[model samples]
Target: MTAELGGRIREARIARGLSLRAMAAEADISPSLLSQVETGKVQPSVSTLWAIVTCLGLSIDEVLGHSPASREPLRVEHPNPIQRARDAPEIVVENGVTWRGLAVMDPNVDAVLVTYAPGAASSPDDTHMRHPGTEYGYLIRGELTLKIDFETYLIRAGDSFCFSSSRPHLFRNDTDAVAEGVWFVAGRAGAASARSAPGPVRDAVDALDAMSRLPRRVGG
Candidate 1:
């Protein structure tokens, strides 16, 4: 962790093309302290590190080099109870979907596990609110309809799509059973709740993928 922190600090500093002295001044810390951190002679306190990260135009997680998790699926240990959508209780969005969420590199990006129930025609919910973020999804199983703007793509398993959140979109469960897929939502925290315990890397990735399916403009 310390090594990752050091590397992140170094990367941030270099990206800004700022010398240690400059960074120290911008971060309101002593140059000696910066040098010590760079040399791995000392680790900065959380507050100090956050200040440095903010001054360097980086996120708190990025500076710490402790992203939510990797963007790869893994075995789950002590999995939490699945939360089914209130509107689609019979649809069972969680377990029946055969999908998983995982962590990714960006905090603003959420990975999701989207399982579409058969005959579950997706409806755009852009009324009263607008979903704000970019969206992208990849089919993991079965077939489904991906609505973007006014066009619909009959995306099949393994296919992928990306679009802005400003446009309305929805996933229709046009298959005979559940259609499994991954959606990555931008600028939303649909999956990685800071409150949740550290679980499998797959959770993070799945949440990101699910989020990607949300409409950029429509609020769902």
Candidate 2:
């Protein structure tokens, strides 16, 4: 339960891109409390934790990491479905590469776990799709080269990068091994903002369409 609470708080903070101090201030709690909550050092009362979760705009189940009982994450399954991996459709991109979107959301951001094969490169997305918010990525394994606005960044396992979503960027895997990473896209929050900003929407659509046209390969 303590581990669960910590995971929930940490996940919420990361998903919302909030610093501990920032979230603490928003929830009218101290940074110490937030840290404790994230580390499972000090369990927060139900009301206190609820308040924090509310400030972060996450549902209880999302925080708790609970799926339906029957569908709980399998530890030692009798017969796992390898077909699920074989059947998961890949969203093809550039250089004979493909991405299996782990998560897709139309609201404020789009995030995915991407695996890149050797010689793979990303297609350029529209700059107009770029916006005020930022994109964050963490390399889970292997090596990759990220080119953002003409600058190349080499990232490896345990490395992370955060930058504006508006940059004309591409990722390439030049190594012999496969590269796996997570991408989190920050999106607009309010309906009024969306209504007022058709430029971003157009850019995002164009960017995604362009990406879809690139060469792609699949990984499970």
Candidate 3:
């Protein structure tokens, strides 16, 4: 699955005529790290994956093998509202975080059950992720540390929080026990928002072209 994901990212970058360095720069990552991610030599953290997809103008669904056309068939074939646990798509990101999708075809919002193993973190580096959206999360078990910009809050089980995703934030499990939670994200830049919105394709192409033209940074 990791290799396949890498292949999809690589294909999308090439399709947009973006160099490895250019895409990495746009994603605010090192070119060597991006190359490793593209080759499946390493798996990216949740934040890194989100950044890469946003830079490539590709939806997380597409990267996860759920294209828009492919999703149509699912809606037509099964109109059931309840999703079976066995059928839920689960993605394990870098560190020890896991995401399980709750809905099959919801375009306006992304609902997922997230699990963070002991010592898990949303990002490997100090940089946090900021996107155009709002995030609501409820901690179901254990403890989690939520860092928003310069502030940090310790969240315990039964605690629920809502915040704008545009603020740089990171989630971490500092305790020895695992942390589990359900998160709902909605906005113009959520997981599926870019693909559902009109003109994203063109905008992505233009952005890629513009970024590709910039000279590579020294020692970057």
Candidate 4:
């Protein structure tokens, strides 16, 4: 998955006629780091990936291989609302964060079951990510640390929270146990109820799509 993701990112960079150095500069990252990320030698943090995607003008869905061209249009009539556990698509990101799509066909929203392993965090370097949207989450198990700007809150099981994505927030699991939750992100990238999926899903799908093209590792 890492290799495949790197290849796709490299492909997108080339397709846009941007040099590695230029792209790295645009993304506020070092050229060597970008090169490592593109070659699969490094696993980029969520914030780093977000920066790259935003710089390349590529949606996350496109990265995940869930592009509009790859999926049939969702039909209002006879909609299949059931997403079986076996059929749900899941992806692992930087650190030990995992996201399983709960409503994969929804284009205007991203609803996923998220899990954070012990010590796992949304960003590797404690950086926050700010985007245009709103986030609603319900913690299902364990504990999570939510940091918004300079404020920090400890979220416990059964506790829910809502915040604007533009607040530069980050999530982390500081306990020994895994933290799980249901997360919904809406209005990302100003995406509306259109035929195409919203930005967050599209973005996540893009990352997952790259993973689908690669061979699974032992115990991955």
Q: What are the per-residue Cα lDDT tens digits for candidate 4 across 1-220?
A: 7787888899999998999998897677899999999999998897788777766655566665554543322312224556567755677776678887664333445667989899988766667765545789999999999998789999999999998665667888899999999988765532212224322332333333322332222211
Question: Which pairs of residues collide in model 2?
Answer: 93-214, 96-216, 96-217, 97-216, 97-217, 98-217, 108-187, 130-166
RMSD of each: 14.0, 13.4, 15.3, 11.8
lDDT of 1 by residue, 1-220 (tens): 6666777788878887999888787666899988777767788897567556545545455555556655332322323333334312112233233333443444566565666667654432322111435678888888987666568789888899887553445666666866777678765443222223433323222333344333322112
Off by more than 4 A, model 1: 1-100, 121-130, 190-220
lDDT assessment of candidate 2: 0.58
Models 1 onward score TM values of 0.40, 0.43, 0.53, 0.54
Positional deviation of residue 78's Cα in model 4 after best superposition, in angstroms: 5.7
For model 3, residues 1-220, the per-residue Cα lDDT tens digits are: 8888899999999998999998787677999989988898889897788888777655677787874543211221244566677765565665677777665343445566888899888766545766545789999999999998789999999999998665668888899999999987664322443334333212212222222222221110
* Prediction 3 global C-alpha lDDT: 0.67
- The whole-model lDDT of each prediction reads 0.56, 0.58, 0.67, 0.68
Model 2 scores worst on lDDT over the 10 consecutive residues at 188-197
TM-score of 3: 0.53
Give the number of colliding residue pairs in candidate 3. Answer: 0
